[model samples]
Target: GAIVWVHASQPVQLGSGEALEQRYDRRPGGPRIHSFQVDGGPNRLIEALDKLPGVIAVPRLGTVEEDLAALVRRLTSGDPAPAVVRVRQGAGGAERSSEDRTAPHLARLWALQQTQELRAKRQVRDAVELAGRFQLVTPVSGAVVLENQQQYDAAGLTPVDPQTVPSIPEPGTWALLLLGGAMLWFGRRRRPR
Candidate 1:
């Protein structure tokens, strides 16, 4: 519904884990903080998180850092918290062989799980609303009603007349027309010149 702000980290080579403490805002306005010792690849993690509702383009900090920083700073001065990604590089960081291999996979799985959870939650919400309350037209729902002119005028809507409404001829009507045409042709052929 609104512009999405994404903050990402510089490219860090894999195998650098167990020595770094990555701390950042889960979301600018989010309630909790995230601290991780493993490098889940900030760019990759952000990419995975992009499936969430209202998320837009995933910005690459290394390439568009200055431009994005300027635009964001000018547009929003922390009015609504942007997604802040905090990644701290530590000394002797490239050590944990196992974490390095698993972090990316874990991060991707986390993103997919979050996406599915959100979708499921949305479906539940829609089902509850549709089942319990009066229905209204929405992007995700629709209805049809054949209203009279008076009813259409009351609702401030235009009603289509039955004559203008599209419909197919009945099978009997088609058969009768075909037989009439064939009889006419036969009569014309049999007539004397």
Candidate 2:
């Protein structure tokens, strides 16, 4: 028999309508089956997963390592997790008051959930550190530094100032100035000795 590795971060719940079973695999690389007669909501599942070491329980959409770390810190400090859990009993008839009281319980459960999340984050950080030590990758284009006058001169590249306003000559401005200078020079040269 071929052994297949499953790398999912969630536990699969089995059964249908009114009869549900929550399964947890505690043994390393082993199959597991669990059946219980209790309300197994997300909070309950998260609480259970938190008890298992190396088990990281993330939401369906997933969360970042930083956020998970912060959650862990808060949970370790006896602070409540910042997650809201809503439990509803029945479809449209009288709602059960017991379900309404589960909110505070959910908050407590979140703290436990964060413990597993934190462990997973630590594992990821350790793995990253280990991998970085084994390989050193450098930029192919090399370092980029601010181009100073010395650097530009060395590289033979001309740098222009874009803020400079070019001085424009008036219509026949240069010609008029040159003509005036010539008249003055001729008058001076032709002066009686």
Candidate 3:
């Protein structure tokens, strides 16, 4: 049997902040229509994310860690208001928006994904390191054998000599033994009894 530990987070206040989500709709021959769905109230940051001029205008951190940290800070900011935002795309590509803002739910989801990614990388690194230390066979670790005695000598490594061991007799040998035993039994029966 094994023990397990589980932790549950506090429930998010449903009416406190607006739930923000983006949707893209494409009809059979219609232009792609992009829209945002807000639950509670209008959010300035959400608007800014949507109408920001170009990709350069949208704000971003240098690294995923930095982005996650920023999201954490926002969630802990203590303002109990719902916000909505959209990402604006420009002709060239996804244009930058004025602010580097993200929906809390979206940010939370992204952070969770990033955490999993980091964990997987760490596990792989640890596994590789362990395999290297113990000389264990893994995807990135393998064994190489010297081709012959000369190769072993050149590398200053002694090769274990092959050992001689007894093995089972062939089928013909078994047949010959059975034949001899039958003949001996028959001869004894005729001469003595």
Candidate 4:
């Protein structure tokens, strides 16, 4: 028996009632899509879906705006489209209520890094980070928040890798003095004729 490794999304499931669900496993950079049939208990599907990048349950299709719907469709479809999409928090010029506040700066920075840097570099870690950040900002639920936090921890994305020097040692530029000293000592070198 050989161990096979694969980068795949949770299986797509056609569940009973409103539970019927599909997973869109986005390729890092290319326009590739994979879907699998989700089996087992609802808990399994729920858990799997929770880990997907930008996996919003879309509780109400009727309420979702047209642009957002299209965006979702494009993201989930198997077309020659960008695998990762930079989703603005209030995209489609949708208005946000006072209750729905924006995420913290660190969260926003993480999102930017995930989508712009890591995603551009085609790193799977980016997706994991993106998903975790999305879950945090979105009103997902206590259970999902806990589950995503676990995922982030597993991926080494949690705690945000502390800095060796938490605060700036000095305000002035160390480089300026060092370089100036070097220039004064060495002076100008004569070019060979």
Candidate 5:
């Protein structure tokens, strides 16, 4: 599969104190639109369209000012933002504005928050997978040979020894542990005093 590298430059602080940036991909196809977001200090919530695959390499673009500007224009020009536009209205009265109407700005904010939460969950899952992989021994000889031994002897290399080991317990083990702990607590509570 062809890999796309989407890169975001260091965010530029806007006049309104919001940091903005353009994320672009450098694949065989033209640059793809990633996302933009308001900076709520260091841990700003970023809203993007989709997640990248493991093998994809997204190279960051140097200048994000143009992209940021474009997004801002699109957002403030009365055209609703994609993710939270539905929150603004429902069924029959989609066009009717009400006092309780959720502004597009607020909807965008909520969407950004949701996006950040999704990103965090993905990071946690990735970390857990990496931790599990770390416990297993990987063959490094092949990688070293392919990287550094372009002209060196490749036929006399000894095969890597395979160590037989069981895979880690499924995450269901954690759920069972929690369930047991809850049951123990309830049993204790039901006892005298």
Candidate 6:
């Protein structure tokens, strides 16, 4: 929903005049990373989106408006792809140079596993991994929230095979209307008698 900036690791200058995202460091005096600003969530909402496949956005019907929720795909970045290493036969195909940029995935986990506290090891690793996964980085996933359709004169969005937004009754108003109708019916009956 907002532009978020994260610092890129391992110093490497981006190609001059590169397009895609406009890098920014909203934090004062923070290291600037490549502006890979994707449509991501902020905080808890994003957290929920990241963990689950999707989140349902129920419509707010306080105003009795006909609102529509459409399925739309948002553009966002996911985890970086791993480098594929291939072997070359000797002379004709020798084992080519290997560049292992990433640390073994399980090293930290193993370290936590080896701690003095045996029972705490798994818990520690799990907690650490989860934190590391969500920390700082923006999480992207399928999220269904009340569609902002009112903007642009509320006519810009057209949901495919739309479902009608049900009209929900205002509690006090409905009760009062029913009471008034009942009183009128009773009064009419008395006059006839």
Model 1 agreement with the true structure over 1-193: per-residue lDDT tens digits? 1354444453544553222212111233322212121222555443443334333443344445564565457445645446544332334864445334434334444434443343435564554344222223332334558457787778776654555333678899999999999999999999999
TM-scores, all models, native as reference = 0.21, 0.18, 0.16, 0.22, 0.18, 0.18
Tens digits of per-residue lDDT for model 6 on 87-188?
233354554344422233343333332331222232444444443432211122122334555643365544422332224677998999999999999999
Model 1 lowest lDDT segment of ten = 17-26
Clashing pairs in 5: 5-57, 5-58, 5-59, 6-58, 6-59, 7-59, 7-60
Cα RMSDs, all models: 25.0, 30.7, 29.1, 23.5, 23.4, 24.7
Backbone N/Cα/C clashes per model: 0, 0, 14, 2, 7, 5
- Residues 1-193, candidate 2, lDDT per residue (tens digit)? 1111222332444423122112222233333221221222443343444444423343322344454455446545866435554434555766656354444334334433443344334454543333333221111112224468898788765554433323468769999999999999999999999
How many clashes would you count in candidate 1? 0
What's model 3's overall lDDT? 0.41
Instruction: Please give the CA lDDT of all the candidate structures.
Output: 0.45, 0.41, 0.41, 0.42, 0.39, 0.34
Off by over 4 Å in 1: 1-43, 54-65, 75-123, 127-193
lDDT of 4 by residue, 148-190 (tens): 6678787665444334213444546677778898887666554
Task: Supply the global lDDT for candidate 5.
Answer: 0.39
Find the 10 residues in a row with the least total lDDT in model 4.
1-10
Q: Candidate 6: TM-score?
A: 0.18
Candidate 1 structure, TM-score to reference: 0.21
